[model samples]
Target: MTDKAQKPSTRLIAVTLDEASIGHSTPDIEHERATAIWDLVEDNAFFPCGDPGTGPYALHISLMDNRLVFDIKREAGEQVVQHHLSLTPFRKVVKDYFLVCESYYAAIRTASPSQIEAIDMGRRGLHNEGSELLRERLKDKVEVDFDTARRLFTLVCALHWKG
Candidate 1:
């Protein structure tokens, strides 16, 4: 076998949020959505088990029937894998994340610098927690770096957001 085939390098070339299905989002949430997709496409590692080809993949994220769906495809649009992860595990984290983000935004506008920094720290902690959870949930299906999981978690939260 060729060296390249033996050691595959994986990445995401594109990411799409199924906004129509998830309903509308606030401008803040929309901004987060755009940022996550941009960061993820710019750099990430995603290796779906059993795929022979190396990839710069395309990912479509959506929420359906309360489950988060990861629709992965090759760069040329060939199907790779569709992973459906239950939202139950993420319910508390997502809710907490939203609350923290709201506080952070408000703090930025009215609170002292120290207070804002504290809230921002909490927000980052919750974000890390959510990302770690995602990594665990996808462990069996795909291998992704913490940074990739972090960005994916942001998109997942965007999918879960109702407002």
Candidate 2:
């Protein structure tokens, strides 16, 4: 076995996530329950939008990582879905990635797995080219397993994206 060096410090610990690790893809029941719990523990919030164009977002159930984000798209018949979200897995103390992921798993317990579609925008202005860039920035942070982060994101969305 190869020996690994211990990290000297975790001050730079910052939780991060990608579009693929969210909670809305789950069933309404599960998502609602998760979001309900989240609403009980948030300060401020907002709905995520425009892939955030590589910037901040709104969170309802605030954890760690002072950043926020959301995915946005216009659906058929003038409906728009802005998938807002939040995370807490940049371990300055301990590894919390799994814990955060657990929340996602719990929320998605009753839902079917789905795929995120590419956002199409030729009518209004919804730039979506920074996805890879955002993903790259989020690489070093934690991840949301089984839609756990969605419940957390619900907190942000409900509160209109506040910390």
Candidate 3:
């Protein structure tokens, strides 16, 4: 991990999801969203390409016209850059993540410990896959470390929640 203190300006300070774009979410989805945001703000590396404003950034995420949007700004609310990533590349992995998540959640309450662990492993794998894809997709626009990408992937999956 990069020394967060040394590169403090490259970190994210806040994250907000567009409520209107969120539609209606189940309690589980809401919990997932909250957890992802809390984890993200606690630790993340976000540096917009070609912008050297020395900014601890804030990110506003939303989905508009079937595109995933990343609205980055300085911690003090000055615009930095905005990126719209195509959702096509994410569709399959996101779908698989959701399926594994559903099974994991269900297994947690009813299955044996070993069974839950198995499902959890699959869930984590899918999460990692999605995170890697996100990191690749954002490579040209914004640079993010693996953990940050994982948390961001969780938020992305939260946005895709249709319940």
lDDT of 1: 0.84
Return model 3's CA RMSD, one decimal. 1.7
lDDT of 2 by residue, 2-100 (tens): 011111111111122343323344465445545555442232222222232221222222223444553322221222233322333222211232333
What range of 10 consecutive residues in model 1 has the weakest lDDT sum? 1-10
Compute each candidate's TM-score over C-alphas: 0.89, 0.21, 0.93
Each model's Cα RMSD? 3.2, 18.1, 1.7
- Provide backbone clash counts, one per model: 0, 18, 0
In candidate 2 the C-alpha lDDT for residue 133 amounts to 29
For candidate 1, write residues 80-142 as lDDT tens digits.
Answer: 999999989999998999999889988888999999999999999999999999999998787
List per-prediction Cα lDDT, in the order shown. 0.84, 0.29, 0.89
Model 1 alpha-carbon miss at residue 40, Å: 0.7
Instruction: List the pairs of residues colliding in candidate 3.
Output: none
Model 3: ten consecutive residues of lowest lDDT: 1-10
Decreasing lDDT order of the candidates? 3, 1, 2
Candidate 2 local lDDT, residue 92: 20
lDDT of 3 by residue, 1-163 (tens): 3464238888888999999888997997788789899999998888887787488999999998899999999988889999999999999999998899889989988999999999999999999999999999998788899999999998998887877
Candidate number with the higher lDDT (1 or 3): 3
